[model samples]
Target chain A: MTFFEAENVSKNYAGHTALDHVSINVKEQSIFGLLGPNGAGKTTLIRIINQIIGPDTGELRIKGEKLNPDHIAQIGYLPEERGLYKKMKVGEQAMYLARLKGLSKQDAYSRLKKWFEKFEIENWWGKKVEELSKGMAQKVQFIVTVVHEPSLLIFDEPFSGFDPINAELLKQEILKLKDKGATIIFSTHNMSSVEELCDNIALIDKAKVILDGEMQSIKQEYKSNAYELKVRDLQKDINEILPSSFNLKKIRALNNCQSFVVELPGNVTSNELLSQVMPHAQVSSFEEILPTMNEIFIRKVTEAGRSK
Target chain B: MNKIFTILRREYLSRVKKKSFIIMTVLGPILMAALFVVPVYLANVSDREMKVAVLDETGLFYDAFHNSDKVEYENIYMDYATARDQFEELDYDALLHIPESALNNPNSVKLLSTSNIGLNMISDMESVIQKKLEAHRLSLSGIDKKVLEDIEVDVTINTFIYKEGEEKQNYSEISYALGLISGLLIYIFIFLYGAQVMRGVIEEKTSRIVEVIVSSVKPFQLMMGKIVGIALVGLTQFVLWVILTGLIVFTFQTINPDLFKYKSPEQQMIENKGLTPDELAVQQENLELSNDKANSLLEGIRQIQFGNILIMFLFYFIGGYLLYASLFAAIGSAVDNETDTQQFMLPVTIPLILAIISMQVVLNNPDGPVAFWMSIIPFTSPIIMMARIPFNPPVAYWEIGLSLAMLVAGFVFTTWLAARIYRTGILMYGKKASFRELFKWIRF
Candidate 1:
């Protein structure tokens, strides 16, 4: 079921358009990756979801109801430029934010204590935020973001300041939250993390969503017709044996096998290419090469720029 | 509303908990009390009796100088040269000399001290000599001293104002003081708490915490909560100052009852000395008249409709603060740091500064056109109208009501405009803010 939906949302600042007809749907218990380059209107869309700014045109619905102020209690937002009151104590600041999210003082305190204990930084509760190291502050911020147990949590560049170990720890925590049936809108430029955790994504460029769908399906759709083949004991050159429809892109010789990268033209099947190469050399292994999210992002953004 | 309260609580608690806030709250009244007590104490401690020796060569002013708490005079029989040589043995502060030609050369009389002669001592000598000279001339013209005394006249004007066909006593001096004080007070309050609102906004923006905050609550709520929170802080400080200053002054009065009294017993004693029955009767009547003036002043103050002035004061106080604070918050939002706020600060502060600068004009001519228009214009009304409240023939009901209504509308309009600018300005970063850019944000 769709947990949050922004339909045809558009926003303009002064005379400049920040977002135009931008829309994204986040499903319950799924992680939605909001992918975009800087100033691509992704932040604007997230802000609209958070209700920090209203869309000039279009509507937002959460769980089949029109989004309103009460829904703010159910949504937690960790902005890209995240910060805590530096002069305030760690636990006090967390309690304050959690209370702002509609948690009672007692509940905020207990939940904050639990999060602080789990993060193994319970001693930091009394320490001011300015006293914490950058990594430590990031961990505290992550805990604060999720402490209210909000049904929908939005984290923008959540792992920007984390070290590898803490980043992995945060990833596990986010996955655990999703397991507990929370909807997540994850916005970042880190495509590797998107590939690892996102179930669906929308890539926005220049105020428009250029690409969006289920992660795997979108990756599948973006894959070119290319395959990597390993063959050994060849009787003839593989390139000479293949028809002109199969373009051999690169060849690399290993100790026991020769690797061939072949691009198949339209209407050409992998089976046909395998069969054509099999007669000339024994095919040890064959695999289709799908595009990485990074490659797809670069390609789509570049294409959008050129078209513009 | 609950969210705004939450934000207000945080804003208020965070600041009130600061060490600086606590220190200032305690120190403010002590400093104010010191401003009063220090000068009085210094004056009392430094006042010393100076003794002057008069050497009158004309020998016509032997009894002219009178002894008082501040100065004493003694007639000397020695000549000027002998007195100058005997000054060390005489142990007197100064030696006065009069040449025989001093009858025509009035400036020939000289006072010489080993150290610098105080101007007070010189004035005392000149006045005594002048009084004696006048008496001598009056005698030469065959004029009686009693006649000269009877010819002196003193007149005082008693002012009254007719309000609603009833005659009421009016004290223009008291009204002038009251108006200036209340007007200046409002000006101080608006600036003190308004800048606090601006600094609070700038802190949130520079620290990057505004985004995190606005996500949960509306920007308008945050801005208002902060402004109201700081206003509460200012009120708290002012109340504490009033209470503490009162306590301090009261304690000092109790310890030394004569600290604030204007007249000393010695002065009364000197005035009563050598007064004939008829002269004493006139003096007693004059004293009673002065006492009646004081009583009338008190009665006038009691009848000045302080209730109306107080109600209007509170209305303008809140109205004026809200208007300026919202604008300050908007300016803070548009700037990245305190330094960048300068360009925007001037325009917002100009109206308040103008109101303060024009207070003199209002006080000088409270019923004039300049005062009337200034009191009606919302930008300057908080101060100008407050100053006109205690004046003669009082500010009209419709004028007060109209000014107040306009103030409410003005604040509402500025708040709406400021909220627009603040919402957009907080989200914009790293850009120098200008009036044109702020205008753009207002449109946004």
Candidate 2:
């Protein structure tokens, strides 16, 4: 069974529909990515899943039962807006947050100390939260959110303030957490991180998912039949001898060699473009160009916008 | 329940442990005492050498406005114009310009000073003029001043209060003390705990911690936990204040032996029973008339019963706090920010202010129609009942019972209303809502 499923979930803020007829399944122990641009309702969907808010329409099921208050104990959410009480000490604040997530005082303290020690922030325990750096405070928030060992963890822009080394450190910790049987929903605009971390992605735009599949499969589905061919070009327009299905997009000539990009139309294969391009110019080498996840994200979103 | 306890412990410890809280708690009484003492000290300090010129045009007040010790009177002023000029030039602290007609009319007195008038100068003028007028009237009636003085005008009436089921009683001192203690307790707790609820709501809402905490617990639980915890904290502080005050006074009483006056000259052989020499000297200097009144007040106090008043004060104090704190919590949740709280705050504060203003009326007329009805009303009962407790009360038991019931009923009803608002309001944002909108949300 899926760990959680949101069926036909809909939410509206005033007259503006934040999410419309959206449905998705999060499987157990998988790192699922929610990829979307700004104002794409990712945070709204995350809030509904966390039960921080209720959907205006539709139902959410946790494990095999309908969602209830007890299910909140199983979900650990880190929202984009980080907040810590400025007047409280870091350690006391962490313990207070942990107890809210269902840990006893002693348990919360022990678990929080372990996390703090792991993050090498033991010396910060006695300091007020306002005294800490942004990254340090975020680390405290991260520890509190995870201290109860929740089954599902949702992080919204979790790596925003960290330097590269600390980002890598947090990345390793995420992987370690997943290995310990936790389902992760990591939402971010950083495509490189998505490429490294996410196994499944649902790209949302305009309050709806425009693309949903495995990361690799979705990337493959959006690839264009374009090729880069290095050739020794004898000057030619290269549009002639090709059917309307094939067109040359770019041509770059070096001292003795040339490189060119080819495009194909409907039902046209990369082989057809390669075969047609070879006759027009002396092709040195040819290869098909698959789109990057960043390109796919941008293209899908822009296409979604244009369609709207 | 355990979650509530955890929340309470966290609230009580962390809040009370703050540097601000500790300093305020420890220094609050000291500051209040300083507030009482500093004015008297400053008055004594700045009044060491007051120089005034007196111009008595009708010769009616030449020596009437006598000056001695710290006050020096110069009789050189001849007219109002000259006095006004010297006053504006800061020649003296003030000029006493008693117009010729003012001494005969008695109500035509006015002080022309450069800067401003003060209470001491007004009282001094009234006392000296009234004494001279009395002496002049006596002399005109062909009576000698010494004969009139020996004739004694003081009236001493013995007031005996007896009840069918109780003994003869004197209630003047007990009533005054009861009103003072009760009014202060109600005033202090309402402010202390009401602000606690406001600060707690603001803290959780501002830190965005309310979002996560609300996921696991209902908004009502969070609100109640904060209110109860802070109530307990207030109670703790009060208990500590009481204990600390008692300890400080005890230390002063047991160690110094110079502070308090004792009534019995016959109990000196009983050792710890009588005043020391300095305390006796101070008591002797307090004058015979005031000492007789003090003895009767002490007798009256011993005749009165305090047991009912203590119970009534506890009930009304807690009940009143719970009622007002609920409203504060509701207001805190409704507006999303403190700036908007003022609009709702005025309604809650009005009743408290009215009750305080009517305290004297309640004390003077406990069984009067106004005090009776106000005491039965829940909002005014906390202070009204306290102020009435000392006046041999004549308070009916049914009134106390009915007031308690109404307060309890009011508390429950308000808690439900506040819970409904808190559940919705804590999550609402952006738009400034109308009362209609807030009421509609309660229904939602």
DockQ top scorer: 1
- Candidate 1 per-residue lDDT, tens place, A1-308, comes to 99999899999877778888987888999999999999999889988899999899999999989999999888888888877788999888888888888888999998888888899999998999999998998888788788888899999999999989999999999999999999999999999999999999999999999999999998889888999999999998675898887788899999988999998996888999988888788899999999999999999999999997
Model 2 agreement with the true structure over A58-112: per-residue lDDT tens digits: 8988787898878877888887765788888999888887887788788988899
* lDDT comparing candidate 2 with the true structure: 0.76
Query: What fraction of the true interface does each of the listed models get right, in terms of native contacts kept?
Result: 0.73, 0.46
Can you list each candidate's DockQ?
Answer: 0.70, 0.35
| Residue range with the least summed lDDT across 10 consecutive positions in model 1 chain B | B261-270
Candidate lDDT values, in order: 0.87, 0.76
Model 2, position B413, has a per-residue lDDT of 84
Residue A214, model 2, lDDT: 86
Report the error of model 2 at residue B22, Å. Answer: 1.9
| Quality of candidate 1 docking, DockQ | 0.70
Best by the TM-score measure: 1
The chain A TM-scores for the candidates, taken one by one, are 0.96, 0.87
Worst 10 residues of 2 chain A by lDDT: A233-242
Kindly provide the TM-score of model 1 when superposed on the true structure, using C-alpha atoms: 0.90
Q: Write the per-residue lDDT of candidate 2 for residues B1-444, one digit (tens) a residue.
A: 666776777878877887877887777656554554455445444454677777777676765554544566776546777567666565776677667777468777666556665577678678877877778778888888667655756676765567777656455657777676778678778877897798678667666677667766667778888888887777767666655665655655566453354434323322322345754454454456666766887787776666666667667878888888887887777776778788878878888888888887777677888787777787777778777766764577788788788889878887888887777677655445667766876785
